[model samples]
Target: MTTSYPAQFLAVAGTRPEVIKLAPVLMAFAERSAEAKAALGVTGQHRNLIDAALNLFGLTPAFDLNLMRPGQSPAEFMGRALVDLTTILQHHQPRPAALIVQGDTTTATAAAWTGFLSRLPVAHVEAGLRTRDRRQPFPEEINRRTIGLLADWHFAPTPRARDHLLAEGVASERVLVVGNTVVDALRWLQQRLTEADLPASARRVLDAGYRLVLVTAHRREAFGTPLRNVLLALRDLVMSFENVRILFPVHPNPAVQEATREHLAGVEQIQCVEPLNYRQFIAAMSRADLIVTDSGGVQEEASSLGVPTLVTRDQTERPEGVEVGLVRLVGTERRRIVAEAAALLGDSTRQTRPDRPLNLYGDGQAGRRIVAALLGDANPPPPFVPSIIPTNSSDECRYESTQDRCGFQWSGPRHSRH
Candidate 1:
């Protein structure tokens, strides 16, 4: 647990979720200034969407790569991020001992790879999430797996996530079940939010006494027909229920905007407007009677608030919600989506809250656990007990590369598996 680098850690964030989830951990690091310093790196992949989240938590990046470009393909964007991140790490004074990236954005994946190539240990927050079928959440599924492969420290947000990493050959000792930081963020926002501070749209909905249903859908796999169908289903819900009010904070992406405009435009009891700021978005989630979205963060946030949610995806990595009956996966099929929403609407009328609040994600202390690990203040797991037969009974066999050694291979400083 000793290193040459200073008592400082590097944090990289790009998307809004990354900003939101990492903010609490960064705040914790800042509080322990005598212990460690946090150096933030913003890839600017999400630009405007990231600002509100950062501002809400009072975070300003020390290293702003400013690498976003409109209309760039994922490969193009990732390539540029990798290059810029390399340059940033190269010139960073008192180089960071570990690089921290949250979730599975291109910025996270690229930064993790860059840190690995630079010989810096990487800590992946919200690690070990998987949908099994990579294509379901294109790029993200593969990205999370890649980070798990390269990360020296995996801060899994759940016991299930930690188990996934262990099953994938990540040393059990390297993974910690710290709970999801999204819950931490939700708890933070909920404490500070009120109806008076809500945006005019959200306040109006609440003032009018309509049962709010917050909707958000902008996943790579959910584009085109899936997006269209979800919108259509929302249209059906608004028309079918007079008291149901739907608030969709449409993403700025052209595909998302065009679809929302095309399918949901002029729909009664539905407000499809531009995206809201972090507080406003939280206000919407806080006041919503039922949540409908394909967002990973929303699933965690809504469930954390005890709101019943309908996930508009075929599968979700955050299955704890689904398992607890707080979230249901109603894929993009219009009939299923409409039916689930309608049923939920009826169910919401019958019950004011879920059967009970499920603290499936976190108890609002994941930030402290993450900070303890980053500062090396937490006790390390006991030494791994390797159970493998060597191919050759020699020191070279133990020290050699995986290809040259036995079936068991050393994965990290503390990782070895059969």
Candidate 2:
């Protein structure tokens, strides 16, 4: 079952967030030909949404297991992914030395389990996320936890995330704070984008004098009545403010699309359109005065761009942004959502940047550091380390001397900047 070239490492991504975050990792592989060989495997869990981001980043997977079926249940889809992914790997000659997955998608979870069962090392990017209450996010919270236990390397986006892994007794040598890849992807997209590249519909909204408010809500927990309540808040906000306009890119799911159209279609100053591609979404975020979302990746992107954000969930796994005042968790209650949106909208003084830089996330070199770790090349510390001191846990981090490179060891509590 050998191929022309053995894929030294395989990156698995099925949804938009996974693809966006993994893009920089693939780029790291492409840039450093002298390092280990790498390839991508797409599960196509989000077939329609995955390609646009992949095309934007010039990425193509070696295997595309078109595993999604119409109206497929999570169990069905994951079972299919497991079977198809296993088949693909079986046929892949010289099998990948390691399998890398991102976030807490079903695809990532399935791939991690497959890798671990196959006796292959699994590296989890954006690892150690937790809401503790598994039902709040419906499977995502559990997915990351399962992967955290199964993974060989845990690339945490922040020290908080790193501490969670250490508290759970994962090997300190295997865990390292490598920042988040979403920041890397956002920075990369922001660099090449100009106004001319924005979608025509988005451009029209921007050209209008109304202050823009971006809204995106598609979490499973927020469906049904919670979703209706969120739309109700949007309606109230639209009716309350004459000068403000909202742009919401409706999710393609029938339940979501039906409810969105039913509640807010043809509403004044609110453009409820189909979902935007990553670039167009970025453009929309750029033009926005405020952002309301329940997405984990959006929290990271909005915080990195310094946009005021409101999370529509009761709890969030990504709270670094909230700590820095870049985000507020307002839940799905109508009055609370409307009140918070109104308060932030009226306050011009709150628009000023934070007094200090929020390095709570990372500086944008996570992809490189992840690669460096994967290849065991002790380079330097990640581009930016947060000011927070590492906590000494009962299971404090300790590094193996044999695995140390460039004299780098994270086992010690003392921070050393390379």
Candidate 3:
């Protein structure tokens, strides 16, 4: 048997969110021939979850590292992935022209670093997102910052994200404000999904004339005390309102699973089940009256669907949704969560406002723009210009000099020509 390498771009994904965001870019590459096609490399940071997302997009990886293990630490995973990725880059026939990675994960950071060590040009997708506080999101903030320093091209998802890179002194020419590919993925999934595709647990709530509050909380920051507060708040909400029901798709993480089982297992009006596949999750989100989550991807998905959302975090990298009134940051405080959820549930008008201008994240053509940029076409797609600029909060680049607070010095011009 002979193995043929058809990949010009070696796109890598380790988690479900990475798979979702990268799927659009891979699809875009598929439309082209000869030097434009990409081959996927799965790091298996999230095993089953990554498989479900890959299946949803009809994608198969050219290489699978299968690195995930129960009770694995980020440091351990990074060490293993770095060695495996290096072997792939060195021995693969017709080495990939560029190494592509998405979002802020240990896998992405490791891959970007490996690419740099291998002297390969690295292109970062969904780049330039920052919460500014490294400890808040733990490791992810630092992982993305490291990638920013190493990547040759930064495919920023919004004007805000591009500005963050510029503030950090990254070359403006290297950063392109391509809209978020999550919107592209969401739009593609929504076209094929229907009400019947929703999980049975979700459908029962809607049929019973009860307002459904879909919940998802799995961030490392929300592991112990914060997660318990959120679960307690959900119990309070259900006990307080007769027409309210909760549907939480529990993450497979041991910390999250333990907390969920201890606080929410066998609780009345709350359906705690295993994680739903991408398609069923999309169907569930569409019919959800309100969403409470700490996942960044869910924030974008809920906002795009016009489903009112309450973010259970102190800060978010994706603040475009908050710039509009569609999303609110309630943090992990029990009282705050209950108050916000109650306020939205009590008012029927706040549930789903489909008429709101919710294209702040994207217009679903981000995949095409990314492909044009990667191919170095003569005419690249125009940059995604957001209609709504943030005013309520200070989202601009706050660095006073060429050197930022983090000690990264910018050598290029501050303003972008594009």
Candidate 4:
């Protein structure tokens, strides 16, 4: 009864988001039949953040590249990751059948390219996201596009994402619309989290009945002036409203730390604590009144929790939340951020409708579907089909007659093929 499985897949993760998104897929692989052996490779692009996420998910990387350096640029990281990943693919015993890279990080791009060069198939998870403008997200847009070119299999999160890949000439059979794995990660963590697990500052804000505004804005595009605008806006919001408390989990980048100290160090209402673990962050999101962030993952997580979010970017690759009125793009202007946050905070009636059924991003089964597809299952799990909910039309939502979930009846073509 002991069946051995070869190392058929090598999953690479380098950032916190990558680890969080990929954890469920890795876990699913373990749950599959013995032939579905998959291994993890860590690049240490986000060092402490990556380790925290891996520990939270109880995952250990088979190969730890440890390629991070102080204030390393994307180009530098790419060069180093490319060299090391190439060596691993070429020399490691039990050579993997394919390379798995999740999301659009420098590590993912480098690893995918290396896999292609080493004559291995590449699978791109969370693929086909696009902001159209390559420079807006500063390399992420470009990075994902490049991965799209090199990847043999594209695991898109939504139908829209699948369309993006198809329009770009990706073969129809090569793409599958698996819902985002973030929802899977959230579902797994929600069972283990409680209100008691929230950070002390967050708990105080909620217990005292003060509005808690969770803020996270650390992106390459928002380094200098844009970051300053966000910090100044937060400072202004807390100063203007006595009952509003800002809980910011600061990133450890030197530039971000320096700017945060310069602008928000002494602010009493704004608590600039160290970065939170994944569990703490999810707990905070569940209880937060409002969230302002420049992170794509936060957008997906907040939407799933039905939390209102203000994205501090001009463009977002994740537009599913925006379409459902759960999120708004406020850009990185000081006045705009303050104005939007003030409006949401001032109006107690403004809330994401609990019954709106905004599962546009996912329904927490993405991991199983992805694993089945990678293993070439003869009967793969059905691709995720999002309920069609129209923007600005609450009356359009209809409950499924047989199920407890809500969705609108759509007359358009469906893409439920596996």
lDDT of 2: 0.82
Candidate numbers, best lDDT first, in rank order:
4, 3, 2, 1
Model 1 CA deviation exceeding 4 Å by range: 1-7, 348-350, 354-357, 378-418
lDDT of each: 0.79, 0.82, 0.85, 0.86
* Number of colliding residue pairs in each model: 0, 0, 0, 0
Estimate, for each residue in 1-418, the C-alpha lDDT of model 3 and write its tens digit.
2345788789988999999999999989988766577999999999979998998899999989999998999999999999999888888667788999999999999999999999999999989999999987888999999999999999998877888898899999899988899999998887898767899999989999998889998899888899999999999999999998999999999999999889987788999989999999989888888899999999988877778899999999987777556689999999999999888888754333454334667778888898899899899878875542222322332211223323222232342101
**How close to the true structure is residue 272 of candidate 3, measured as C-alpha lDDT?**
94
Best by lDDT: 4
lDDT of 4 by residue, 179-244 (tens): 999999998999899777799989988888898999897898899999999999999999999999
Q: Mark the 10 consecutive residues where model 3 has the least summed lDDT.
A: 393-402
**Model 1, 309-394: lDDT tens per residue?**
89999998887667545689989999998898888778523434433333567767788788887778757433212121222222
lDDT of 3: 0.85
Candidate 2: the clashing residue pairs are: none
TM-score of each model, in listed order = 0.87, 0.90, 0.91, 0.91
**Stretches > 4 Å off in candidate 2:** 1-5, 353-358, 382-384, 387-418
Q: Write the per-residue lDDT of candidate 2 for residues 21-102, one digit (tens) a residue.
A: 9998888887887767788889999988999998999987888888878888889999999988887777777778899999
Q: TM-score-based ranking, best first?
A: 4, 3, 2, 1
For TM-score, candidate 1 versus 3, the one ahead is 3
Evaluate model 1: give its lDDT. Answer: 0.79
